[model samples]
Target: MKRGFLEACVLAAISGEESYGYQIVKDVPASMGLTESTLYPLLKRLEKAGCITARSAEHNGRLRRYYRITDDGRARIEEFLAEWPSVREIYTYVEGAHHDAR
Candidate 1:
């Protein structure tokens, strides 16, 4: 997936509730094959974009920064969800083509 599209998925992962970077890494599919390096920069970009917010909380004697979706983020997610059906249809068509090649 493109970086911008993947960022939307990251936003979706946080939509249900606030979550830490590590938790999100686990929650999002391994197929997305995310890493801290890729994710943290995306998180920072989202924060800058006003799509998300970060708050630090004490946990296990350490401060963990949690990412929460903002109203803008919700709007963005809604937009992506609305746009996803077309993307899904493309994927389905591509997959069918790949299968026919076998």
Candidate 2:
């Protein structure tokens, strides 16, 4: 199943020890299999909602803005986790029985 739209940012923040846009673009596919365009706007919204923050850093001699999840972002992840069981069950059942040609 495709990860939820915002899931990339949350996981990316956690994985990067805090990360910037390029890092997220690189890591998200490994974590969530999402593309840069899909993840960037969600990060922007998370920032706007105070669910994350960013600061500039030097990496490979280029400046980049790194992101960290806020307390609220953590809370949101918890909420998503709480809801995951039902979502997972539904998808699992659907996929298992779906298009079976036996």
Candidate 3:
């Protein structure tokens, strides 16, 4: 459940344009707790899923991998946006109930 949301965030970050791994992690919210260890695996998973494409280019005489959003990735973003309202409502309800409990 939460993994889908994480995937959506990664997709959105790369959606702007192809970006390197480090830069992609930077674009994500700090609250996500995304670190290189976490983000690298997630990027590999996304690439394996065909949601995005990774290509290597030489910059400063070193190979750098850049991620680009695919058509499927864009569609995924749309799906996430559509479900966001319901997710928001759930969060609101849970927070209210939890606060009352506290």
Candidate 4:
């Protein structure tokens, strides 16, 4: 479940434009706890899933891999959005339970 959320976050980060690993880490909120160790593997998974496409380009005399969201990635974002209502309901239920426990 957390993996799905992280993937969605990464997808959304690049939804506006293509980005590299370092930039992606910067683009996502710090609160998300995104790190190089976590990001590279996630990027590979996203690429493997066809949710994004990667290309290498020269930057500062070095090759940088940039990722752009694909049609499937956009569809994924939409799918995640579609699930939000249910997630909200669950959150509401959980929050009520937490309050009751107080």
**Which candidate has the highest TM-score of all?**
4
Put down candidate 2 lDDT per residue, 1-102, tens digits, no spaces.
354645634554554388767667776546465567867777788889877887888879988788888888777777777888898899888888885744
**Which residue pairs in candidate 2 have backbone atoms (N, alpha carbon, C) closer than 3 angstroms, thus clashing?**
none
Greater TM-score among 1 and 2 belongs to 1
Please provide, for model 3 over 30-62, each residue's C-alpha lDDT reduced to its tens digit, 9 standing for 90 to 100: 778778888889889988888899999999999
The local distance difference test score of each candidate is 0.91, 0.71, 0.88, 0.94
Model 1 local distance difference test score: 0.91
Evaluate model 1: give its TM-score: 0.82
Total residue pair clashes for candidate 2: 0
Rank candidates, TM-score, best first: 4, 3, 1, 2
lDDT of 1 at 44: 97
Candidate 1: residue 56 lDDT (0-100): 99
Instruction: After superposing candidate 2 on the true structure, give the runs of residues whose Cα lies further than 4 Å from its correct spot.
Output: 1-9, 58-61, 99-102
Candidate 2 lands at a TM-score of 0.72
> Across residues 1-102, which tens digit of lDDT does each residue of candidate 4 receive?
777788899999999999999999998888788998999999998899999999999999999999999999999999999998999999999999999999
Clashing pairs in 3: none
- Could you give me the TM-score of model 4 versus the true structure? 0.95
How far residue 10's Cα lies from its native spot in candidate 4, in Å, is 0.7
Deviation in Å, model 3, residue 64 alpha carbon:
0.5
Candidates arranged by lDDT, highest first: 4, 1, 3, 2
The C-alpha local distance difference test score for the whole of candidate 4 amounts to: 0.94
